[model samples]
Target: MTDVTEEFRLNLAHIDGPLAIATLTGDLDLHTAPGLRTGALEWIGQGHHHLILDLRGVGFCDSSGLSALIGVWHSAKQAGGALELAAAPDRLTRMLTLTGLDSLLTVHPTAQDVLSTHRPTADA
Candidate 1:
């Protein structure tokens, strides 16, 4: 069995005030989805609510990965923050649309675009 971390990488970066960019790489499957969820939740817990998931490097994402995304969105929302997707692959976008998650989660063309447009206020 492949190690979860070996198959996936989640790099968190703080950009544009309260916004956090989680740049994910590699396949996001059942083996690695939990780590993504946990890392995002930890970031949110630390008061970084506004999150942008940079999925450009993500080559594959399965149902479990989608579920983790939803869970992260909910966690961010509950923390008075928002979640957005940047540079998602075409297949992931299609899956999101098919599952109706596209409506619930905001998708941006690129992380730089999101940084330019969104200016989230710091939590008081």
Candidate 2:
């Protein structure tokens, strides 16, 4: 498990096609949400709209994490893009599902699944 005390780190990469994926580790709370937002926006601004977030290593997530995701979704949508979650832990899945976000956002069992199979919808 990652040290929860440390700040979350965002790692970026491009998979097949223009899909830009960010793998997040550590806790995603209010303090780190802004950075997450900025990083994602920077990628989107660069003409990368397909996003896959790998959250399997995330030890903890608060409202800030959820908020950050919502913000990314809205921002990506405005640019005609889509954001999908990959390898979300059960805790995160439960948290998102309880709030009905599971349906709104695509959730995959693993990053590879999202990377290989995800096709952006027409509406984005």
Candidate lDDT values, in order: 0.87, 0.83
lDDT of 1 by residue, 61-116 (tens): 88899999999999999988889999999999999999899998888999999889
RMSD per model, one decimal: 2.4, 3.5
Give candidate 1 misplaced runs (Cα > 4 Å): 1-6
How many collisions between residues are there in candidate 1?
0
Q: Which pairs of residues collide in model 1?
A: none
Q: In TM-score terms, which candidate is top?
A: 1
Candidate 2 off by > 4 Å = 1-5, 15-17, 119-124
Best model per lDDT: 1
Model 2: number of backbone collisions: 0
* Model 1 lDDT, residue 48, Cα: 80
